[model samples]
Each structure stands twice: as structure tokens, then as C-alpha cells.
Target: MLAMIEDRALHTDLALERPVPALQAISHDPSLRTTVALRDGRRLTGVQAQWAYLEQAAAWVDDRFGADADADTVEVLQRWESVLTRLERDPMECAREARLGRQAALLNGFRDREGLPWDAPRLGLIDLQYSDVRPEKGLYHRLLARDRIERVVTDAQAADAVEQPPEDTRAYFRGRCLAKYGQDVAAASWDSVIFDLPGRDSLQRVPMLEPLRGGRDSVGDLIDASDTAADLMAALAAR
Candidate 1:
């Protein structure tokens, strides 16, 4: 059934006859073929990608046995590395074959050797566990607590990111506006923020066409000087 669907997709929307430049680039770029990405927007590829897989598998072994991990984890890592190394030879083609129903990308052969049959329900359960977002219940957070998942940023850094937008981007200006005068803001989009002020006949739309223009350095003092949204608008108009 999957193969038939894959065939349909390949011959239709994803057909080689109709080439998308970005997709074509991804096919050729090994760095873009990462199966895992970090929260700090870093891609795991090459040795880093292999190491990530090993780290997860090793952590699982440690979790189960609570023993010296070196020996117990080595065999599993070797198997995973073997599979990943082979896949990396032609990652895009490997992915295509897997999608087009090639019996789960050589892992099925290893499972057969181990006398373990394919288990769709078990796979689905694992997927569900990973996606669970509750910190106490999620598989990922559990691993995170154990320091199994690699940390790209400190807890404080992540918390700070949640509270504030990047200072270098136009989001700083937009975020400051929302934080200060969100009640007056009727609507907002990427390119503009619309304000519905008191005693105003029409909505005031502030254009944000230049992403680099509205950063902290550009508008921080202006925003600081304005007492209200109306004052800010007037100051902008005078400029």
C-alpha cells in the first residue's frame, strides 16, 4: 500500500520531471539530509549526526541496565553506525527507497537476523512517546533530565529566549510594541501592525517593510520616548 502511494507521489507532485530547486539542492547536499536537528537551529550531519544516534542508543542502554555503559553500548552503537554509514553513501536515494517501500531501510534485515518481526504498533507507540510534550511524561524530557540529549543552550538561555525576541531582529521593535500597547493593537502581520486607537476614525497601520530597520538600535529610543501608541505614531509621522 505504501509503495503504491509512493509511486503515485513520485509520478505526480514529487516527480523528477518537475524539478524544484530547493528539493534538488537537498538531494545533493549531505548536510541537508540530517534526520535530527537541535533546538538552537543546528543540523546534525556527517560525524555529528552519527554521534547523535549513538548518544541516544547509549543512553537507552544505560537507562535499562544501570551498568558501566562502555561495553553494553558498543555493540548497539556499532550496528547503528553500520546502518547510518551505509545510508550516508547515497542518503537521498536511501530515503527515496525507504519511502517507496524497501522494507524499512536495511533495519528489517537486521531485525530478521535477530528473529524479531516488524512491529507497527510498537513503532507507533514509540512515536507517540517522543511527541508527548509534558515535561514529566515525555520521553524526550526524561532523556533530557538524564543529560542524554545534547544541550545546545543553557536552561537560563532558553528561558530568556521564551520571554524576549532576538534583539538583532525587527521582532524586538514588534515585541516591544506588543508588550507595551498590546491592548490598542487591533491586528498585526509580518509587514505591518494595525492599531485601533481611541477617538481615531480609522485603523493606524504601521508598515514594517524593512526587517533590519525596526531593531533595538534603530527604534529603541523612539519607543522609549513615546508615552502612548498615538505618540509613537505621531513621532514616526514627523520623521
Candidate 2:
């Protein structure tokens, strides 16, 4: 779930954004148990319970947004209804559809809140666990545990990252904000931060959603030359 949230934060480019949807599918002995955690933090257990929650959310959207609701919002509710209709006929299909439909609804809800377009790329599903491994013998376990310490990012790099946006991504722009305005100003802004440049009709807002595009060598020169966040942004923009 944490990975999912991070992915959403880094990749969602549409004007709309929302918290990661909460849906857990646990494999039981003979069936799968589905759980839905609502935005209010209420957990709905069982297929029936989840369906009921969707129904309420759909109704609430209609009541709250009324004529202002977008087509995606309406479609999400309709999709839920269709999934519910299939519950008795095909339980498996119903479960699959319910998950997809609920995800769409959750994302669209963000669009409703911000009055933004729904054109961002949909999130791809990621498997969080591996299932084929069996317990090893004591000797095998000891051998495996020998090399348990793994270091992906060095401590120095992580410390630099706190103040400098990654040069390979849009985060470089965000780093500029932090550099110019200080941490408090940058931390308070989200999605995009507006800047009052000279030529624009209105303030320019820089989005921080683009993923890292640099390789090991891509940001080397910029990192070496940069003494401040502003310098880093300028070097990255020049690149």
C-alpha cells in the first residue's frame, strides 16, 4: 500500500489526484476474502458489505455534485451497479469487476473535488508478495541469512536528496521551490506550485509528478556543480 501511494504521488499527472484506494484481497482456503477500507477509515468486510458501501458512495456523489458531476463519476456508479448485478450469476467475475469499478470511483472522486480532467494514466497493478517459496532447512536458512543486509541508496545520497530534488525528474523543479522559499513554503504546497514569472498571463505552476529519468551518469555533472538548489534547477533545465 505504501508503494502504491508513492507511485500514485510520483506518476499521476492529471489535474485530479486522490489518496490510494484501499482494497485488500486475501486468499483463504477455498475462496478470497475482499475488504474495502473507505476514505473515512471504515473497513467493509465481505462482498456484500463492500457493495453496500459503494452504493452509498455513489448516492452521496449524486447528491453532493448534482449537475456538476462529470461523466466519469456517473460511469463509475453505473459500473458498480453492473458489477452488483453479476454477483449472483458469477461470483468471481463480480469480485473482479467490483475491484475495478471501485478503483475508478475513488480516482474520479478526486476529479469531482478539484474539477479537474480525468486523463491521467491509470495505475498498473503490482503484486506485493511471492507465494512459491517454502521453508528451508536450518543450513539453507543460515546460508540465506548471511547476506541479509541490503543497501540500495547510500546515506550521503539520501541526505542530499532531502534538500535537492532529483535532477532526472520534475522533482528538480520542486527543489527550486524549496530552495527559493525555504522548506516551510515548499512543504505546504502540493501537486503543483505556482510561480510569478515575468511573461506569463498568470503564475506558472510546476508539477512534481514526473518519475526519475536520469541514469547514474545523467546528473553527475549537475550534482558536482550545484552548491544550491537554484543552481541545480538551472543546470537541469539547461540539460
Candidate 3:
């Protein structure tokens, strides 16, 4: 965003005034080494597409701004390159990560060089627009309502997700714990949950390091039968 803005403001004739061509060329390449399926049945191709885009953008920045460019530009680009390179080990994951979402404001800002002045306030508004959570007010929600954006999950599924966790994941157990004993949970993470049970000498840290274990199918009955978190712990320990 900064690069393009500065590019226009200074009349620098660098390539990629808009990222459309670069994104399109990479994504639609016939010789793509990898492809990943989106939930909407679309396929994303190109393993190093994002890495290449960033590299191109970095070059543009260097050419247009020279020493006036941000000091961390190279470092940020390098970091993105490193991450993308590592992701290439899994082509599907790499392809999925390469997918980028953009807002109308951003595209308009890029094209309306004369209208939306390349300034801090405009940039900040564009950057922070998505952070608005209200469905009626948020720019993202408005786009969603207009079907300008694709959804990975439907509204019904999302609503159900609020009250239920996946039956096949360890999240089921964690969700059950929260539902039955949220008051006892002091902290929770992907691999563990800390329980601060009353009358206990110390907090009990339950390690859920096994990602494949503790699903609803494996522990639903046990959880349903247990009256308290301690009872559930005892039942789990018995297993």
C-alpha cells in the first residue's frame, strides 16, 4: 500500500502500479508446480507466487524510493520470503497461503491516485476499516452481504460453531470443559488447559499434547457422566 502510494505521489514509473497483473499472471500460470483447492471449489496454483509478488514489490520500492524507502522493507520482505519458502515444502499449504483478499477501498486507492490522496489518514482508514465488528457498519460485512467475498463456512455453520466444537478434534473435549466448567479454567491453549479449581492446592494443568485424541466420539460419554471438572479429570486419568 505504502509503495504504490509513494510511487504515484512521486511520479516514479515503476512496474506494478496495480498488483492485478502480477497476481493474475502468477495464479493463472499453466506451468504451475502446485495447486490447492479452496472450500468454494476454486483451485489456487503456484507455489512461490506470493514470494515472487513480494520480491517484485520490494524491487519496485527500491527503484522508486531508493534510500527514502522504509528501512525495514528488505527485512520484512526477507521474512515473508523465508516463510513462503518453508511453506513450499507443502504445496497445498503454500498455495492456500498465497491467496490474498483485498477490499474495494484498497483497489480504489490504487487506481484513484488523484482522488484519494496518498496520506496517513486515508491509509489508516483503509487499514483499520476491517477491524469494525458490527455487521451493519463493518466494511467487510457489507462486502459479505453483497457476496463480493467468498465464505469458507455458511452462516448456519458459523452459528452452530459458537455452541459446538468439531466432534473429531481435541477441541471437543476443550469445549466440553469450557461449557461445564468455564469458571475453573484459568488459561487455555491448543495443547493445554489450566484449571484453577476451588479448594485445590494449585492449578491443574491438563496437557492435551495429543492432537488426535480427546474427541467427542472418544470422551463424550465420560464427560457427560462426570459431575465436576475433578470428576472428569479422574475419568480421563482412568482411561
Candidate 4:
């Protein structure tokens, strides 16, 4: 906890001129690679395809941004790359991340499309994927553990009371609010009616928000944080 605060204190946002030269450089590179072969005489371009896409990483990214935009975009893209590197480990970590990520998406997608609240009971895809792994062992166990971390990370800024709580107890608290807010966060701020949810069969009470107001801002923040949280969780789980 102390370390996280220190790291946060030392954090600095990179300032770049819009429209960095990344795309231009990528454009200049000949984006191509030799396809590979497969066993059983099955010829597949897996390696070549991967390399080809890697070579064109900056192509799909718009390069017409102004100087400031370019720099900011590049920084965002670099951070995204770092995140991908963290998640792209062995199959075990990938599976867990995939589960956690899909769950986040399932919840967040409602905010983007339904014009509705992010209620909890509407599990849908997340529940389906989660349900298929009933016997929580092997990959599912890792995924469950990862889910706990995901829940923890989603609750960044949980509360800084310990000898060093998480880097931001608020972030974690926000996550707790998000998970508990059900589906009414589009109108009011969570702070308006936050309370503790009943524990699971006599467990300690966990803080939860009654309704997540200021839905736009808070949901957006949760999604952004969840993005990096997914990567970080996958990496740590792998280790």
C-alpha cells in the first residue's frame, strides 16, 4: 500500500505533440512477412500473419491527428501495448483474462448499448461463461482467483486505512460501488446512497452503492481502469 502510493506520487503523464511520427514511420516500412508451414502437410500462415499484423500495428490508427493528438495517441497506444504484453502469456493466464475481460465487457456493454442501468442480475454472457466452469478447478480456478483480483482492482481506491492500503482505496471502492449499484447509475452519484451489502451467509459486510449516479463518468472510469486491471491481473496470475 505504501509502495503503491509512492508509485502513484511519482507517476507522470507523458505530453506529446499531436500527430506523432509513428504512423509515418510505419507507413514507410514494408509491411509483409513470410508465411509459415504446418504439420500434416497443412500449410498455415500463422507466424507470417502475426508478423504482418505486428508490422502494421500503426496503420489502423489514424495518423491525421494534430501534433498534440498524435503524441497523446502514441502514449495511449504504447500503454495499450504494455498491457497486451502483460496479458499475452501462456494459455492459462489468457483463459483467466479472457473470462474476466468478457465479464467486464458484458457488464459495460449494457452501459454502451441498452440505454439502461448496469444491474447485477443481468449476468448474460458473463454468467454463461462463468457458469460453464462450475467445478472451479484448473483454468477456472485461476480465472476465479483472477476474478477476485479483478474485483479488487475494479475497486481501486478501496480506502486508505491500512499500513498501506491499495494504491487507491477509492478505485476499489468505486468498483465495489459499480458492482453493487445494480443498474441505476445513469442518474445519480454513488456517493448519494452508498451502503454495505449483506455478507454471504454471515460473512463481513461489504460496502456497496445503492445506485450509481453520474453513470457516464463513473462507468467510463471503471471501464478505463478495468482495462489496465485486466492486464495487470493476468500478468500477476501468470507469475
For each candidate, C-alpha RMSD in Å? 15.9, 18.9, 17.4, 20.7
- Give the whole-model CA lDDT for all candidates, comma-separated: 0.62, 0.48, 0.67, 0.39
Q: Which stretches of candidate 1 lie over 4 Å from their true place?
A: 1-119
The residue-level lDDT of candidate 1 at 212 comes to: 70
Best by lDDT: 3
| 172-203: candidate 1 lDDT, tens digit per residue | 87888888888999988888889999999999
- Flag regions of model 2 displaced more than 4 Å: 1-26, 29-45, 94-239
Q: Write the per-residue lDDT of candidate 4 for residues 139-190, one digit (tens) a residue.
A: 3444555563234233234443322312233344444434545342332242
Ranking by lDDT: 3, 1, 2, 4
The count of residue-pair clashes in candidate 4 stands at 30
Residue pairs with clashing backbones, model 2 = none
The segments of candidate 4 whose C-alpha lies over 4 angstroms from its true place after superposition are 1-51, 59-63, 70-76, 83-89, 93-96, 100-239
Per-prediction TM-score:
0.54, 0.29, 0.56, 0.22
Prediction 2 global C-alpha lDDT:
0.48
TM-score, cand. 3: 0.56
Total clashing residue pairs per candidate?
A: 0, 0, 0, 30
